[model samples]
Target: MENRLFYVMFCMILLLSLCSSENYFTKNVKGEGVLAKNSYVNHPPNPPIVEGPLVGLTRKAYQYNLTLIDPDNDLLIGYEIDFGDTIEGSSCCPIPSNTTLTLYHMWYNPGVYNVKARTKDGHGLWGNWSTPLTVTIMEGDTVPPVVHMLKPNKGLYLSNKRILPFPMNLVIGGITVEVEAVDEGSDVSRVEFYVQGSLKERDYTTPYSWDWYEKSLGRYVLTVKAYDFVGNQVSDEIIVWKFF
Candidate 1:
């Protein structure tokens, strides 16, 4: 009887040790114990959105906007852009979810091209490429207008008796924002000036400028978008501090 009791105790101890150790059977009841700590099944992001012009010119740079969303609400890290001509470009950086990114590309040969993009999640998983945007490239001058911010050039300035950074421009009271725009293919139609993404003024003549006098004192984003007679457009922007 004593021998039988000893044998039963030994078996129980062995089973307990196996369950307490790193054995798979210890916590693996009903598939709950098999997963590692803080681990879950990863899902890829949804298809991206590609928006741009449908007709372009060969050997001319054109801009396209890309936007994406992750089904799991994960942060985006990078993107893969395919121009459908055996050339691919990739951008890697930490970008917020649902943010739109602008990319530029030039085609060397004239033909029909399909543009597509895919996003990479925080988990390093690449989602599917979006539906291709068909673009037809031909031989012509489709170059966008060239724009430059004349005033508020990147430099240091005084604001409220404090020395600002070298790359920041400080404005006291009111400042005149000016830009220079030129087009090689067609005449410039108009230049639109924007402050904090709001349309402030429109200049239809050369020496494009706008007098910005707002009582609100803070940092503002100044943008100048120039459009040509042929619908080709380009933009230039600057950041300035307003203290008045």
Candidate 2:
């Protein structure tokens, strides 16, 4: 009996040692589960909605992180962010308990992207990729006169001729742009132009005309804004570069 007791005690010690040790990775298993102390499951949290074409890079701390959520709470090794098309960001493991993903901008034209949080414990069980979160670049740019191109559409604006489709730079084609002006909350309306790129003009109204000049050539984009009688406003861009 004494020998049997000794054997049981030894086994208990061995099991305890294993439990106390940190867990490195838990593969295959997923969905609503717990991790042993020092253990990690997989991946990171989801991404948020972004606006604008490039959401201009900002110097802000937008911590987008997720929890490993393993009861063992093992010592995680590191992480990586893969934003499609070979775009990637990474960090060492044993991730900061309060770590978050930092981004230069929140907006993109239109597409899907994701982030990955890689964690490794002292164990060799490599965890699977984190839950992938997809995001669609915001498309809510309602500003009017939506300038469409960088180069003017035509060298000649002949009367009674359907103008060719104008395009915008730094953006994909098929975007809508318009111009209009009106009095404050009144029906009165009119349009004006202050050409500056290649032509010199101070103030003028719509249905304006200009002569093409060979001397004036290189780069030119038009910016126009329309206002309503009630003092409403809209803006757009136009590129001028069509030659006869």
lDDT tens digits by residue: candidate 1, 1-244:
9999999999999978866765534256575655344435689988889999899887677899888788888888888888878545565677777888888888878999999989999999999989999999988657899999977676544433334546678777666777999998867989999988999899999889888777658888888999987567999888887777
* Collision pairs in model 1: none
Candidate 1 C-alpha error for residue 211, in Å: 31
Off by over 4 Å in 1: 1-39, 142-244
Which candidate has the highest lDDT of all?
1
The 10 consecutive residues of candidate 2 with the worst lDDT sum are: 52-61
Stretches of model 2 off by over 4 angstroms after superposition: 1-63, 68-71, 85-87, 96-108, 114-116, 122-125, 139-244
Question: For candidate 2, lDDT tens digit of each residue in 70-94?
Answer: 3244444544445443444444545
Candidate 1: residue 150 lDDT (0-100):
79
TM-score of every candidate relative to the true structure: 0.45, 0.28
RMSD of each: 15.8, 15.7
